[model samples]
Target: MSINFHEVKKKREEFWNSSLVYKAIHDRLVKQGYHLIGTIGAVKRCHWTKEAVVRKRFCYKCLWYGIESHRCIQMTPVAAWCWNRCLHCWRIQPEDVGMHWDDTRPPVIDDPEVLVEESIRVHREIMAGYKGNPSADQLMVEEALKPKHAAISLTGEPLLYPRLSELIEEYHKRGLTTFLVTHGTRPDVLKSLVKEPSQLYISIESWDKESYEYFNRPLVPRAWELFQETLELIPSFKSPTVFRFTIVKGYNDNEKALESFSRFVEKAQPTYIEVKAYMFLGGSRGRLEHSNMPSHDDIRNVGRILSEKTGYKLLSESIPSRIVLLSRIDKPIRHGKGCPDGVEHPEKYAPAFSKEYEELTD
Candidate 1:
């Protein structure tokens, strides 16, 4: 069924206020140490934003923060409506089917400028206490309050946003780097995005077409073909690419699937591969049992299998969440060839912060 953007928008607005799906997402973000800054925070943290403080706070605190403050900012494009309803998804509901631009409704501001202004206001209010916290360093606290980077995979398929390319371009102009994640459901939309992100991620949930359909429940008519097309296009792009595999226990966890996935990755030749376990949350609870969540040891074993088969080496593992990052040993080049130093050169590309922030109303 084709999606009706306006009708779906209204339903999504209702869902935002009443659905468990919204609560699940809010809870998950909080647990992951992310503050829902929305659009208001986006304006205040204009130049020296710490985007990572909200989306990847757990990672920032443990790995990137003080040890490598230079790499601290990271943010997600807080929006909704994904192209697929995978059984393993932790943040959405099973009933949430099909694609619709209106997935994130009530909170939606008219334009990017208004959104940024509101973001600054909301962010300041939320982080007011950190201003005087003795344990927090002045610099760190300040950085944490700003929004530096953006991850365009907060909820919905960001590519579906009518002005996604413009939004991305705006972020680049502000000196913020972009990390875009797509489900490979819309090759046309993926190809149309104007800006080149620092890193691009394609979620290849299953090995075979049948498994993909069974697992992802994609809305697009030609989902499999689009997935293949997306893989084929990855090599042509200069940006670093990642193939993320969300491993679910008793599903796509065997050696055959691993071998298939490795072969596909070889074709794509991405810079990094992230293998993560499926957490039992949201609609997945009704479809899958808690036992479906694999243990960290299980993830390690699977990572080893893929590493050996694909000639990739394991760089790190998050034991608690059963996630692993594998890098191609021979491919020494980082995700963004020019971004090796972790510094964003806006003159070379787009600015990271939005220029609209300058005109935001109080």
Candidate 2:
């Protein structure tokens, strides 16, 4: 079905204002200034916790959060509309929840400078009441209020935004690092990005083109070709690249599929590989059975199989969410100079080419 970006945008606005989940999340993000958006149910199910929130506790299990103890500030840039309605996605839907392109994206302010100013202003207003909340940790609260990094992945394909490259450069000039997560549907947009992000992530949900189409429900006609092309070009860029595979039980979790996935990773040679289990949420309930969410052991087994095939070591695992990290043993850690943890600052980290772009643009 061809998506009308304008209608998608309108529906998203209506949904964002009316949906309890969206309001709950928006309220928290506005108050805290930043928050991680991912599968809360997966986190809870893995951790065996009654709490439904996906927060620092769950983040502590993640490779990036585990490695960087002092780092603060994380948020997916936009809250609505994604280009692909992946069957594995946990977000609830009638399949067009927010998938619009027209004027649906937040309007491009007349002045970039004004947009920055308004962003800061809105951020402060959202955080106003939290100033005196007794339960709030002052240090973490302060960090959350600051705009250190913007992750361009929340619910949608950020590259679809016509002004994405411009927005990335603007963030870079503000000394904020940008993290872009793409579904690998648009290589042209990826290629055109002016500022290299601290990290560029491509999600490869399935190894085979047919399985990819079956799983991702991408809007583009030739998504598989685009995914392959993007993987091939990842090595040429200096910024850290991550290949994310959200493992679904009956779909691509078997040995043959995993082996094919490993070969793709070997060819791409990204700095990191994340293997995560699919969580049952949102619109996925209609299309997938609850049994599709794999167990922690299942996730670990898959990781082991892929690791052996790719010669990548299993570096970390978020036991609660059944997620694992794999990396080449020989991959060198290029610690950014400003990062105190010896790991790149979550916000300052960018692809190696970002500096060149920054210099050229200046």
Candidate 3:
């Protein structure tokens, strides 16, 4: 439980500036294994990052792209702010704990360089537990200590961080690839980024305005329009773009939804499309039913339909994650230092400790 308290005064200032909301949110997030860095940034060890070293199992990112799961840091610059309270998102939302604040921005903006450096420090501290595990490979654990990829989609709309472009640049300067995921609520932030991530992911959960409001529960006005603006902006990015669909069974997986999704794909023209099943974990368990979780076959079926609709061929499937990859090109674009040789592919194994390690940090 070694957390990065970069400046206690800054932490106090953040709490004072935002009333008690910040403290309440901070304690809860800390209990969830998120090490708060500076006033706003945080780093939480990914489940796959641990399993990669201890069990030789990697996440779908490793199979799809070449990210070595063990050598990746799952983090966020603004952990408590987001526009959308999507029903399927696994992270806890403000309202879930009977707390609400301005989700539009953070109470305090931390330095991006300090965020990157301290996040990596916390990442290594979190990995220390895995090093002593009997099943851990010492060599892999050593590599895990030196993270090479930053998954900046941990628990918030990272675009709200204000200095996100600088954060991405800091990570890149340290030789780490970044995968930034956003809810498409901030087209302005996307456009403003001078340093783009290695891969950009937009979480597109619904097809139309009605469904968007229904599932996303976005706080801002005209959220659908903002989303459309982001879709249009995706094609302008020089780096690879991804449209990620977290399919909730009997919700967005219907025929009509598929048609609308195809239309969105046409607009964005992202390098890849990921159709993944909505995971019934974390705060989502309180919002959605376990029955909403789709089967791997369900995901594959949807992938087939989208492939036909968008002409993005079904390139691969990671059955354990219930995710199918649709690509306009022949193969996935690898990023960062890839998984080492002879690593076990996730497709052959069951989902990586979904329940057993759901509570682990770092």
TM-score for all models, in order of appearance? 0.69, 0.69, 0.91
Residue 153 C-alpha lDDT in model 2: 63
Q: Determine which window of 10 residues in candidate 2 has minimal summed lDDT.
A: 41-50
lDDT of each: 0.57, 0.56, 0.82
- State the TM-score for model 1: 0.69
Question: Which of the numbered candidates is closest to the native, going by highest TM-score?
Answer: 3
Which 10-residue span in candidate 1 carries the lowest summed lDDT? 60-69
Model 3 agreement with the true structure over 1-362: per-residue lDDT tens digits: 24445464466455645667766776778787778776777788777787788877777788778898898999998887888888887566777678877867677788788788888888888887776788999898899889899999988899888898999999999999999999988899999999999999998888899988898998889999999999999989999999998899989989999999999999889999999988877688888897888877888899999999999988777665678889998867788445432123444532544422243133
Report the backbone clash tally of model 1. 28
Local distance difference test, candidate 3: 0.82
Q: Which segments of model 3 are wrong by more than 4 Å?
A: 1-18, 337-362
Error of 3 at 221 (Å): 1.0
User: Given candidate 2, what's the lDDT at residue 103?
Assistant: 20
Off by over 4 Å in 2: 1-80, 90-129, 329-362
RMSD each, Å: 10.6, 11.0, 3.5
